[model samples]
Structure formats: structure tokens, C-alpha cells
Target: MSAQPAETASGFATEGFDPATATIVAVTYNRSHLLAGLLESIVRMDPKPGHVVVIDNASSDDTTQVVESFRDRLGAELVYRRLQENTGGSGGFSEGMRVAYELGSTWMWLMDDDVEVLPDGLARMGAWAPRFKSIQGRRYDYDGSEFYWQYRVSVPLGIPIPFAPAGFDDAGYRPMNSGCFEGMFIHRDVVRRIGLPDPRFFIYWDDTIYGWLASRVTRSAIVNEFVLKRTREIRQWDMGTRHLNASSNMYRYHIMRNRGIMAHYYRAHGAYRPVYFAIGTAATFVKEIIRLVFVERTVRGTSNLWRGLRDGARIRRDPSFRVMPPLEEAPS
Candidate 1:
């Protein structure tokens, strides 16, 4: 789809983009304290989001109460949905996007409860709406340093380009094929074309595939503008330029298991590389082993890698493991 320029009454030109047409979709699970901070940040936005959709993944805590407290303070409409069970970040985002789309939102700003949006973040992202449909804003690490996020995807290998440039170009933005859910600002039309994030991923790599799909249909890029700050801090291995955070056993399992699902996406997009993917998968297993032995100082979770590999192989062969199509195609 092509973007058309139009000027608003205030003389600001856009591709029919308006902040009032955007909806914030946040997925929270047992993090009321963090969720409250995120909501507070949204309330302070210069042009506050037109709507807020919070998907509570069956948290036993007071997540519902915290959301209600902001109803009066926030000027926008708030919709809260609590699931009966935890559906992981992927499922929550999928549900939240579905809800926001059903509400007729033109734009969806997706994020997690552990991060707080900057007051001018949405405005900076909106400036590029006249040019691109799938956009990602910058983020701050827990230590207040700039996060390393700019990179394109190696579809054949199903991994991000490790040696990609670190910063944006002279245009203040860089084209990207991978997507990060932390601060993804996308138009509804892109969602209509790419469909919701795959829930089967459960966690890891779902955003990358979604972003790749969006890039196939529109101009997808990540801008050099700080949009949010990560509130949660975890022990990380300093890799000179970047830091590799510690991962839980569950994360390790899903991260490996999801590679099988990723292969399915690669083949669907006509970029399948069996030998390269297998080599990459083996390298990942070795890396995880090193992290567990050196960084984590434990080998208790080593079985997760093998189990994940087994499950992934099964999923890759299953005919039912398919990409979800757009519910409604964009108007031609």
C-alpha cells in the first residue's frame, strides 16, 4: 500500500495519520507495580493515546484494581480483559491487537508492562507516519543507556544480522526486517495485511516474523528516537558493545523450540535454508550451553535445549503449524 500525504487543520502534513486514532496495547502478567508505572507514563503523553487495551494474563495480583485506578486520571477510554489462564506474551499481544482492531483503531502502539513510554515518544514516531506503516522507536536500557536494537533479519538463517550497523542513518531512521514488541508503532492497515502475531510461538521470535511479514507489504523501519525505558533489570553478560541478559529455563526451552516454528515461516516466505538453519541451531545450542556453564553457573536446564529441538522438529512437520492469515484484507 502507498502512503498519501494530507494536511491536518493545524497545517501538519501526514499520511492520514492522527495520534487520536492510535490505541496502546499492553500485555501484563502479575506485574501491577510495573503496569501502574506504564499507565502513568501513558497518561502523561502529549497527545495521549486515543484508547488503551490492557490484556491481563490471569494474574492473581491486583492488576485489575490498578488499571481501574487510572480510569479517572486517563483521558482516553480504557479496556481491560483478564484471561482465565496465562497465555504468554505472544498470546496476550495477539488478543490485545484483536481487541484494538475490533474497536476500530487506526493505529496500535504495542508494548509490555515492564516498560514506560516517554512523553514525546508517540509524537516522534508519528512524524514518520507519512512515510512508513510499520515503525519501531528506540528504547533505553535499565541502566539509562541506549539499547542496541537496529538490525535486519537473515531470513534464511532465521536470525538477526549480528554485524549490522549500530546507529541510524542521516535520515534519522534505518530500514529493518525484524520487529521488537517492546515499542512497535504500526498502522492498522499493516496489521490487516500481515495478521496478528503467531500465538504458537508463546514467546521468542514472534515479533521478528511478524515484522518480516509487515515489511513484505509496506515500508518497515526503526527510527533513532527514544520511545520507552525498560524498568526491569537482570544480570547480563557484557559483550563489549551489547549485553546478553540471563534467560530462564522456560525461556531457553521456548527459544529453542520456536526455531522449528521459524523454519515453517522461512519456507512459507520462500527463504528456507535447511543446512544453514541446522548449523545455526547447533551454534545456538552451544551458545546456550556456554551461557549456562559460565554465566549462569548451572547445567540443570540443559535438557530444555534437547526437548525444544525435538518439539520443534515435530512442529515443523505438522501440517497444522501454519501462519495465521489476515482476518480482513486491506481495501484494494
Candidate 2:
């Protein structure tokens, strides 16, 4: 795609900021059906990405064949890697970003296999490239309603700013202290400064911490433009202002277990609030319990909550837990 000149004085130079310099990095595990839809959406992107990197997490399905079916279909270069074991979303994204960076991509668009990019999604996000180093476009749920939680992130509480106005500024963007990897369009410099998403998380909160770290070094924000459409359908509880989706037992466990990882990041960044985090953690457990009993209509996996909390408390001392360097220090 041809580059457009920056329209504002505060905007950086737009040279080399087009989609041709961007790489779409996606991770999938046994979701060939969903992956095929995402790949098909890429085939329809207005200005295609420079490269497409798909990290297969050892799926015992037709994922390889599905990706192969699109080999010659995509105008952009396609690179596929199938790991021997399932390393989950964190590992897949880490490896995908590493490959994209080594490929010399100026921008890396990170997402899962479940969402399809809008035809103009890449183009719309690119329009803001000259102004923000880290950017996230809007997303639509399966029913075509806007995903409301992508607006603002409260770095101190380590969650989306609750009850914050969902509207964007007059500039059509809202400043964000956190990021969602689902459709995050980030510059290479941010990656270099913050390093890849910590794989130890293996599932949840990795994106939150990664986005928070990116915010420390750049103008991170979520633009008021829809760029992705989620294809997966899940039961959601509408709370008037926000919606809480039902989650799986595995995700519930990670949501609790990963608090230690979040605490580590917060402490590393000097933003850890023991009292506040503890309160928040307690509140989260209560909400999950309610979701299980009422929304999910079962209490089968309640034990995971306690087990995860116990593991989370002890995880800080685990020798394998990674401690990221300060943002000022360049990534090793």
C-alpha cells in the first residue's frame, strides 16, 4: 500500500508505515476451521500485510492442510511453524513475534485464529501508525455488537478501567495503558523495548502485562474503529454496562494462577499494590464463582479457583519464573 503523509504536526513521518511493512502474526491450536476463516479474511485485506506468520501449537487435526490450502492464495509471504507440543497462546505469540522481528517487519499485528480481520482493518490501523507506536483497533463480538472492554485499561488495578466511559475522544482514539493482542498493531521499537510476551503465563494476563509494558514506552491507545470480527460464540452475562463471557475451566484456572505473573510485572514496574491487588483478586474469585454457579449453571470446576490461587501465591518463588528487565534496558 502507498504511504500517506502525516496530517498532524505531532504525527511521526509516515514513510514505510504501510501494510507492506507489517506482518500478521497469529497462533492457533487445532482450530483449523477458525484458522481458515482468519486466513480467508487476510486474503481480502485491502492492502495485504508484508508477511503472514502462523504458529501451529501441535494440533492433531487438519491445521497443516488448511494452512497449506492458502499457501499460494495469499499475495503476502506465508511462513508456518508447527511446534512439537502445545505451548498455548503465550508461547505461540512469543515465537511468532520473534520470527516477525527477525523478518525485519516494521509493524507486527498480533491476534488469535478466532477473529477475522475486516477488509479495511489493516488500512484503518495503518492510518494511525504515524501518531501511535502501539495501537489497537475495535472489535465486534459474534453478534456484531462492539466489544466494550477494549477501551481503557487501568494499569494500577491490572484490569480494564471499570465503568469508564466507552466513548472515544474527538480524535477518534482513546489512550490506553493496556493492550489486547487480539488485534494489536504495534511497532517494532515497542517490541524491542518491552521484549516478547512472557511465555510463562501460558495463557491469560500475558497480553495485559505486555501491553502495560508497551504503554511505558509509547503512545498506546485503542482507536475507535472496528478492525476485527470474533467468530466464536459464547454465553455472556449482560450487566447493563458491560458483558461477562462464560469461560472454560482451563481459562478459569489460568485467570487465577496468572495473578502471580501479573504481580511480578507490577512489582518489577514499581506499581504493585498488595492491598489493592488482594482486594481485586478476592473480588475476581467471587465473580468467577458466581459465573460458575449462575451463568455456567454448574459448580464442577470450583476447586480450580482455590488451587490456582494457592499456586499463584507460591509461583513468585518458582525458579523458572521470568523476570523482565526494566524498559530502559534494551531486550537481550
Candidate 3:
């Protein structure tokens, strides 16, 4: 449960980074069963989190009851909030992080309710906290196979390029340009400086942007240590870039819409070279067409693809976007 504190060089200071200073902020929808398993795992984590907050996105299920059951069993302070409306993953995390920050947590570990953390995962992450502002844990499927989470994006084109399957030495880390929220541990300083994630994303691309923002401000890396295990098998649409082909209409709509919105955001902010903008847009179009024919192989999917692209082109950031208040003060 303990290791010698890592010495700090520049970025995050390891001296003040304590396991007890980290708060686990998990967001869930109607998956009470999965949420229960996740909570159980958190309690068993070595050097457990300082506190835990569960953000329920207006689940019609017994999500509230499940969290209540753990209130007494968990080793840390547990707070459960059920929103009046479903704000999707984007909003749920935004609210959860806000609460964690307000509660004075030094680090917020963001995740969904489907994955279980290894007993020593948090401890492992803590060892590297002094060197990086953001640390992502390695993830594996329930079957014990490592998830291909090392995917990177092209510098200017923004296309996904999966890293080659490889091994890492103990305590080794790799610089990351993108990451998922499943096992992302971040310092409160990054949240305070960069601001909360844009809630308007509703679902997709929000985490990627947040990860980029964190990396921009301070050092970030993916810890090669397997600190978490995914309980479910990887789904078909889980493939990078080919995700649109295997997704439902709703998911497809969001993915396409967010892609365009993010593209414009990056361009306007000069995140990438302007010369490659046309190349990136063209590459995306070609990729979708190929996916529709080979992977999706349905006329209906084609229609949805076109519609998503058409509607997505008009997508813009919500000017009224603001971080939601803490659960206690949230409007009815």
C-alpha cells in the first residue's frame, strides 16, 4: 500500500501528493449492477481514495439504492447525487469534478462505473504523481487481454493511429497525446487552470479535448502498469476510426457532430497547422465512406452517416455553457 515517494523534477510536486488527497469521481447512468461492482472494487483498493462521489445521470433504475448500500461499507466518504435530468457522460463528469474540487480534493480520479480498479492501482498512480499533471492507468479486458489504449492521433490531421502492441518495463511510462476517462487520474491544479470540461459535448470527444488541454498545460503520460480491469468485453464498435460504422444512429450522430465541432474548435484556436485542415477533413470523409461500404454494409447506415455529417457541419459551441453547480445547489 505504500512506496517511497517519487522525487519531483518540475511539473507536479510529489512531496504534497498523498493517496488520501485523491478523490474518485465516477459517473453512471442506469447501470446499477456495474456500479455496484465498481464501488466494491474501490473499497478494496490499496491506500484507498480520500473520498468518492457517484454522479447518477437520472437513472430510472435503483442506482440511488445501490449507492446508499455502499454508504456505510465504503472505507472513504461517499456522496451520491442523482440529477434531475440525464446530462450524459460529459455533464456527469463535469458535475462530479466540480464537487470534488469544491470538497478540496487535491486530485480527481475520473472514471465510468463499468471498470474496476486493481488493489494497488491508485498507489501505483500516486508514485508518478510528482512528475506529471495527468496519469492514465493501463486497462485490460475481463479475459486478461490488454486493451489497445495506446492509440495516438496524427499531429495535424487528427486521425487515430493505434500504437503497435508492445511490452513495457516495470515503472515505465509513455508520453500520451490522448486518453480516455476510464482510469484517468488528474491533479486539481489542472482542473483549476484549464477549467471544467465543456459540457456541451454531451458524450464523445470531450475527454480527448480535456486530455489535450491537460497535456498542453503540464506533462502527462500513460502508466504502463495495469492498474484497472474492464469487466465487459470490448464491443464491436470499439475500433478506432471505424467506430462510426459499428455505432447506433444516436452514437453516430454524436460522433459525427462532435468531430466537426472539435475540428472547428482546433482550427479557430490554432491547435494545428492550417494547411492540413483540408487534408484532415478529406481524410475523414474518405474514411467514413469506406467504413460504410466494408464495415457497416447497410443502406440505412449510409443515410445516418450523411445526415450526421450534414447536421454536424452546422454544430457550434453552446454560448450559454457553464459548469453546473454542486449537487446540493443544483436547480430542480
Candidate 4:
């Protein structure tokens, strides 16, 4: 774990700053080529992290080789672990963060392998470290245009509210109660306070629930100064409900199940009313039906929707869930 000191007026890091305390925890699966580009961007950061932990979700490709290729170029020590089984994105991050905290990291920067960080990304984020417990960096598509994640979770209705993206450019930091893990910067204490992200979610809504938990305990914001470029284009919302219809069976299952689980969480905690829960659940079911009839033009996917909602209703929280153990060395 290491970092070159930032160039400052005094030619040193801030008085008490120790770069070794920050670790970047990145998760990847099957996209070795994209992973290589992300590592390259990390190597170019003006103020790099002390260490980087890459969690591979049992990718059946040369992902390990991609990490090894960058060992000589990165200032931060690279710790790559390929999981024994595919545990999905939620599991990868859960394990990576646990390893980072155990390594004595005071801060953890979370991201996906599909992003290339700006050269000064960490440097700019480090400036706001004192003011917030967690900070989410801005993101742009491969084309260099900003990605608009305009909707935030409305906890009561268990739905999303469209927020205007207009005024954020002038604000140094925008306060946010929810979280997006892509380019998220968080202090170690917050992790200890809230616990690692839930892996049962498998993929969707895990970060959203985790982010909400963090905000409940301390401050979090979106920083507009730093940037991360997404390597892939998102076609998820291109054809209205067709997007949902086109998703893989696994994705469709989780998309529906996770919402029920999240709704269960909010309701159990008394954050919303029973009436709103009824409305939310009904709305979700109707939307799925619309996709099957109007977009997919087939009834085959309906079984997954029904099964997901059924399982989610009975899915109890696991308080003793442990993150997957880390590897002693990068795999060959």
C-alpha cells in the first residue's frame, strides 16, 4: 500500500495526511479488457490510493492476467482475488470492502471496473474528505457527456422521484440521502457503523439500501469536481418497458425481488405506512405486466416476476452474513 505525495505549496501532503490510509476497492467480472483500462486510469491519478483491491466474481477469462500486467505501472499495491464462485456484483464489493477495512484503510473508494477515473479524481475528492463521511463522484459516458441519474428513491412510496439535474453544476457538493456505488468515496468508520453491503441482493438495490443506511448515521454528498468515465453505453432505458422485458432471466428476477426486499426493510423499520406499501407493490406488479404484454409480446417472463415477489416476501435478513475471505496472493 503506497502513494506518491501530492505537489503542494509545501511540497508535501497535508500535515496529518497519510496516503496509505486510503484504499480503492474495485469489483469486476468477465470484462478483463475494460478492467485493464480502469487500472491504467488509476495509475495516472495525480494522488493515487495506497492500495487497490480487485474482487473478481469467478470470471472465466484472463482477468487475473490483466491485473498482473499493471503491477509495475501502479503506485498502489494491487491485491487481486478471484472468487471460487460467481457471487455477483453485490458479493464482490462486500468482500473487497471487508478486506480493505481489515488492511487498516481509513478510507475506501468504491467503483466498478467499467470506469476510467480522471487524472485528478482522488486529489479533488481528498480536498472534501474533512467535510463529509461519504462522497459520490460525478460520472460521464464513454462519449464524455455527463450521465444523468436524475431519480432518487422515495422511501415512503418505495418509488423514485425525478430530480432536476440543472443546478448541480454550480454546487461544489450536492447533499444526497441515497447512494450510487460507482465512484463512491467513503470513510472506514461509516462501514464499521453500518456494516458491509448486503450480498443477498446479488446485484440490484444493494448499494441503494447500503447508501440509505450510511446517510442515516452521517453526512453524504455528490462531488461535482471529480469525474469517472463509463466505458459502456447504457441501453437499459432506451425502449421504455421493453428494457425490462429484454433483460436476462436472472436480471429480471433480481429486479423484481430486490424491490420487495427493500420495501420489507422500510416497512419493518416503520419508515412508511402500510397504505403506501400496498400502492408501491401494486404499481410494481402492474409495470411488469405492461412489459410482458406491450413490449416483450410474450407471457414466458411472468413466472419470474411472480416467483421473485413470492420469495422476497419471506426472505429474512441475515445478521451474521460474512464477506468472502480474501486470497493471500493474486491468482495465476
For every model shown, the clashing-pair count is 0, 0, 0, 0
Candidate 3 lDDT over 13-97, as tens digits, reads 2344577789999999999999999999987876778899999999999999999999988899998889999998989998999
Highest-TM-score candidate: 1
Q: Give the Cα lDDT of each candidate.
A: 0.86, 0.85, 0.74, 0.74
Model 3 lDDT vs. the true structure?
Answer: 0.74
Clashing pairs in 2: none
Name the weakest run of 10 consecutive residues (lDDT summed) in model 3.
321-330
lDDT of 2 by residue, 1-332 (tens): 56665332323234535677999999999999999999999988777889999999999999999999999998899999999999999999999998999999999999999999988777788888889999989899898888876456666566666777788768898788787789888998888888888888899888888888888889898888898999999898877658778888898898889988898888877998888888778877887998897778899888899988989989855757666653346646
* Number of the predicted model whose lDDT against the real structure is largest: 1
Quote model 4's TM-score: 0.83
Clashing pairs in 1: none
Question: How well does each candidate superpose onto the true structure, as a TM-score?
Answer: 0.93, 0.92, 0.83, 0.83
Prediction 3 TM-score vs. true:
0.83
Candidate 1 vs 3: which has more TM-score: 1
Model 1 weakest lDDT span, ten residues long: 1-10
lDDT of 4 by residue, 26-122 (tens): 8999999989999999888767789999999999899988899998899999898889998888989899988998888988989999999888777
Which is better, 2 or 4, measured by lDDT? 2
